[model samples]
Target: MALSPPLRQHPSGALARRSLLVGTAAWCMGAIAGCTSGAKPPSPVGSSSFTGSRTTAVAASSSPGPELPTAVRWRPGPGEIQPAAKLAAVQLVEALGTWPNGQSGVRAAAGRAAALGIPSALAAQLAGQAGSLLPPADAAVIRVIDAQYGGILSDTASVLVVCDQPTLTGRTVRPGGTTVDVRLSRTSSGWGVTALHPAAPGPARPLDEAAREVFAQSRIELPPASAADIRSGAVHDSVLHAMLQLAGSYRLSVSVVRSGHPLDVFGTDRPSDHPLGRAFDVWRIDGHPVVDPATSRTLITEFMRAAAGAGSYNVGGPVQLTGGATANQFFSDDTHHDHVHIGFTA
Candidate 1:
């Protein structure tokens, strides 16, 4: 099958060979096109930014030689659709009614809370954990609808929830919350909740937390490299600094996990950076801070370029941002969609 424009090539060097593996032709791209959501969508090239994942390593000799550009095809996920405002409004009302504090706030707050659904649950959890002296969230406001997916059989919703707490301390508490995507299914009694597993709540650690997780995995201490040594100083402080900065810019959190067959995204071989304590991955977007569009690309592009530039060090990628031969072969290597692999050699 033909590919979209050829995958961009990293500059010339040992890293260049690594780039070939990053976007190889082995991807059953036709099979997973339907899985677009969050940051991994088939966006139009140019005038838009792209998000992606790591793939299995492809041997340099086995890559299929040049093929023509084929029309890009993306499959629809189960029951995914844009809900009408009325349906959205009704769903919001039903969601709000499902919560425990619906009766404590003004009708407006209740309405807002209902509209956000599971995100409300996350907010409530954060406030309780924070030990807010204020009356628990009486309601939630859909401050932003970060992401939503109408799945093939069930739909999922992702958003940021804002809530109000009435307190005697005369102070307000803000608990950033992320929703674990409620699955919507068609029921005889109309659309009802079929699944809400993997519910994300507040207390989702900050970028600093993600850094600590990465550092914790380190059994031996290597001389600490400044952010510049890691990515030419484009990123500084620690992995936490990179993650927090990335989260703030990307409007998401950087998840760091050492194990769990279900969540191992970088694949079977431990990524180079994971062990050396120089690499990390960005998996989910809940409770993660949002970055403005301008700064959004700052950290991401910097890393991509840095990785491409420091090709001698790590073994992972989507490979190539400009400068030609672009491919997305890394998806085939493992469960890497929605994340990037950054390995450190120091």
Candidate 2:
């Protein structure tokens, strides 16, 4: 397919590639630290500002390559959508939510303050907000459930992040979370967050309706955190829409949904999409286990294809398929042997 006019005009490859490299390197460092003897495993880093997992490959030559067949073709609006800027927005929001009582811990979580070009005064103001909201005796964990680009104009961008905030005292409990609007500006260093606020309340999006319906059916059971998030509209609309569509055809046995779960991809430092509510897992389709030999291979194959058709860009299960809108969009992993994972992109 032809590139969007804006994507065609702007230089984005270099910055995107750089962002991916940095994100991967950071994951590696965290992983190595976790395995060291006597070293406490580090907390999983929040989603990288650059999300390499979600990408669209552009054809290099005029002849064009095989098109990624999809129900909807992903398009970029005018002006380059800088991955660095999106990443910075995520990082800044995370930093604001993760402040602990101590100055050192607060500084670590908000380390990107300088990179985000936040003035010292504004940074102090943010710290004050955090201090008032959280108890010093308890640690607060902020998980980004999904982030969507609200708008992008030249060097300025607006992003909306749906997140869950759980306080860890004797036990972890999530009261609820809200959608936050983060505004960022491009800088020599990269994207820097300049302003933050709550998104204005509005009517339900497609995903919100779907989530409510699925949960109401009570046929698909959800993990507690996922249930709470669904009730609070913390799950991303895209993910909820995909699930609702899938559920219409097959009875789904859900495994994970959002918070109150592990935050990283198993054995890797890369943040899992579950926390962002952009992903979900189904262990059974129509009462058949995906990994069971009794289950028909054709059944699993069709479901995977249908998932992609339902707007999921990433699908994983016991079986891997080829020839989709993108190569390797359908994958298989040992961790996914027992279920099917459907992931959406912002």
Candidate 3:
């Protein structure tokens, strides 16, 4: 397929080959494709980013690859904040979006959600907005790419549900996806979904020179919605520039960019860099999920540092390191254990 943007050059002493495998499940979207990316010329890639039991690693020339599930149901690799809170968000997204044959419509979707113990009113509101079909899809699966913490606090939290939707209509399947900002509150029982904000990117616009380069770079694997954000040309140049520069070295699987993120820092009134298009989240560095205990500490640490070199003012991930122009320039917590956050001041 001929697309905008240009290929990228590999950086000196780049890390080992890495790959990103999409989860199995469908949502409502346009192109149904599994995301496959690699550096120039096919070579040995890293393990599967799937957190499930069966993981199939993929290695091919830098081109779009087939969609494969890391697992049937999504699960956090390791330490995460209020795993139940994130789980509630994921379950709700799946419930409202995914349905078996013969079970279709808002009422049916609401019933599915209510079964998960979601409040009736909340379930109805979410199901109402979940979307509907005319003849209805033979079936739709919710393929959750990655669910990372948007913010975490004592009483409230935000989860960024990044995923793709592959819908089966008749014999043909369509591919598409959207990111959702799921809000939750801490209750006596456990974390529960208080609200859901699916991404509305408006419309696509021509990409800027930098974004075009980014889109063309195979090393930088962007999920559907994130790719759309960049294609819409809303992302800041510094973000795109940093991504292009980073792509030269490490293959990055970006999870979130501007949309489907919290407006303010979780648990605080401070503004979040994401909504401003000055920040992005990386769930996998060089193919190994940051949340995975088996991923190398040295690899993640170096990547975080390199992000700083690429002009990120703030970098957060599972590892904490010292030394920067400002305090807290590099931070770590449960919210970031699952991915690396790279933020630019401009």
Candidate 4:
């Protein structure tokens, strides 16, 4: 099998982090094009303390971007692709999905994208997709949970943007969100979004005990698509049980579950544990993002070990760890560098 391909050049530590912290959609859409600052990237966690299989080719970069206005939020981890590319992927979602009171429709959404530098025609095409997805009245807010690579090579990239959305209409507020696979093409101007594919969650089904517990735990943040996966009873109880156990110690910012992820592992035909509901990915732990070089190794190591204790058959994160019951219980791979993956066999 082909291992993760080597990057032609590892970006200088200085350029590794270029994107900046942002709060509003207006700022994010404008910043993604070229507005960023140079900073030393957080140093990588070494492989000495962890173990596992299939090191993914993706590297973790801690470039910050737009965040929610509320205490409840999610952030983009360092991405597998270029920082600008990932930011653009996230910014496009924000521009299209968010709006203020009295503004909700294709015209409003398209206008936001056009202002963000997306081509006017393409912006309209993208906005045409909103349909009933956008609430007709009051304000709609979308919070990006994480932006990881769906695929990347040469000039094309697909970023899986997992997020949660809430629409406040008068006194009634609705909780909702979706996973959008944003496709971008390299352009002279910068990364340009070419398409957006949103996840279609199945109708909600009865939740099992573990699922119910995870839902009740606000600290265990779940994007709308993943919440639906658990609600549909599609996620395995073992996965839910482990999540609840993990939630006991650390606040988990889960990125993907059964929905909005490829059915198989990124570079292989081997069926992924996720689609089977046997695994989950955490982009952030206790407010420290795994992709951030500044994140403490001890924190991640303890969490991975805790996952193993919670009965995960496989635990993958940014660095390799020691003292696993099995030889490969802990691992670090490129794709997994930005998040901690807890996978169970049962």
Candidate 5:
């Protein structure tokens, strides 16, 4: 039997379904560094002992807030300019967290957001989008994990906001989040976000040259949208690198990367993770079709476990594996019978 197309689900609840689509539908309309230090040497000028790095800290003080992942780079200043700009960007993101209680609430929030540097019209549109996405009964909270300046020119700047949201799904709660790119321009008042867009995944742990070579040589073919997403660097680095690593040994065939609307699980409203750019589907491994009876289940099992080892929180395929990050991490579903789905967290 020919397998059905795999589906993706958004986890932000209803808001996720709508917002993610708004983000993509919006699309339908259409870097890095690091350092090392044998710090036995004075921890480098303004550097704090907490982060244990020479890179200048971006927070207001050395007090340390949330720890940033190794892949994220934070360069606070040559002066107060970058830090100030960063503050403006973050404020707009925070303001966007307000869940409108009703149409009136949306208008109020949009009006307030205008002060943060977003244009009134655009702010209202966003407010309307958010209002539609969120349920009236439950409010959403956004925690800014970290923010970094992507570029800073004389009059404009770009920032990437990494955040987490504790969302209510009926009575049960789950973790959900997304990264956003906010662009700001200098106005009479300071920096303000003029445009907001979903950010592509930044480097988590970059694939080594050898692994990247494997990615280039592998016969894996991704659909146009998925291919564009990968080229755009939207897929998590670890996930891409891990998949490529598998390609080095196996004749891997990929069916989907990121494109199209999210798929609701067969019997649930919860969205799959693919549209988030954190998931991929593999139809064949080592030249053996997953659905072929002659193929050893052992290969599929090993691949699933390897996915977990590669930092995936979810792996679904025709075979069930013994150990995974979560009890239901490995799933068997008719839609996935011919492919293995590997998903990662932000």
Candidate 6:
């Protein structure tokens, strides 16, 4: 029988020391100097300590020493294919997180350009004469997409990216012939951008690299829903995300149920919010609703009122509503009494 490919070893100094110990006492002793200090170390209260050499141990409460860099290995995870695509996604996310929030004018615009997956070199192109290029929301959107997508990408794909841009007025546009070349590669730290090229040729084929990157970053073991399910709308996606975020924060599970009714639709009454996919009904794992009817109504109202304090596309669940019920909530009536309607922007 053939031997299986070896799993990637954790980058550990201990492993290297162990490897050096084979067949030679001197090698063992030399490699394990921490054990040969000639000093008697303390043992557990009930145990004994003696001997020529002893291994030193870190105290339980001690902070771990610096970690070694992980080595690259190409064993695929559940949804992984080629590894390069995954790396591209990681690169984009890392770059986006570098933007500082709260600036204005040219700085803001430059941040937006960077968020749109613009090359670093071209980031300056988006700067406005006054200050920053992007507003807070745009900067935030970029950060969200990067973090969410980066967290989801696969670990094998390789990628490279460029984020430079020169400013023209307050907008930065990718120039036709001056496009930067981005490249990436899979690494132990996940995908890393390896190169950026300018005045280089572009790919002749469609770069599903974007999709591959997104998929790699967010790869999960579950089978994807059907196309129809995906097409249900961004509203569904937004609300579900809010539910997940809320559930995660509380370390709880979310159960969803549809409110059944016609013109009497419980809370807010817009067909799109329910049937067409603007709202969600979240419950606990035990099948109990997240809140009682009276509480839910009050909570929903409060949630919408608080939305102004949150990021865009942030309405959903019991505690994590983004604000503006009439805008975020399409329906409010008796049908939604049991389950809280987690609504999202239209």
- TM-score for each candidate, following the candidate numbering: 0.30, 0.40, 0.77, 0.69, 0.39, 0.23
Q: How accurate is candidate 3 locally (lDDT)?
A: 0.65
Model 5 per-residue lDDT tens digits across residues 131-245 = 2223242333344444433334576554545445434433444444444545556655555555555433333444555336535774554433344456555566766777776
lDDT of 2: 0.49
Off by over 4 Å in 1: 1-135, 148-173, 185-193, 198-329, 332-346
Candidate 1 has an lDDT of 0.27
Among all candidates shown, the one with the greatest TM-score: 3
> Candidate 6: misplaced stretches above 4 Å?
1-235, 251-269, 285-288, 291-333
- Top model number, lDDT: 3
CA RMSD per model (angstroms):
20.3, 16.4, 11.7, 10.7, 18.7, 22.7
Which residue window of length 10 is worst by lDDT in model 5? 27-36
Selected candidate, larger lDDT, 2 vs 3: 3
Model 4 compared with the native: what TM-score? 0.69
Q: Which prediction has more favorable lDDT, 4 or 6?
A: 4
Q: What TM value does model 5 have?
A: 0.39
Q: Quote the lDDT for 212 in model 5.
A: 60
Please, what are the lDDT tens digits per residue for candidate 3 over residues 112-218?
65666556676676666654211266555556778887877786777778877666555555766778877666656566666666766557898778988987899
- Candidate 5 segments whose C-alpha is farther than 4 A from its true place: 1-215, 219-223, 261-263
Q: In model 5, which residue pairs have backbone atoms overlapping below 3 Å?
A: 8-263, 8-272, 9-271, 9-272, 10-271, 27-30
Q: Per-residue lDDT for 133-244 in model 2, tens only?
A: 2334244434454444434556655554545554434333334344454555565656655555443223333445576687776456453345656766767888777777
lDDT of 6 by residue, 175-215 (tens): 11111222333444333343322212212333243222322
Encode model 1's per-residue lDDT on 147-169: one tens digit a residue: 22211222222211111111111
Q: Which lDDT tens digits does candidate 4 get at residues 50-88?
A: 232111111112334422223112333333437667777
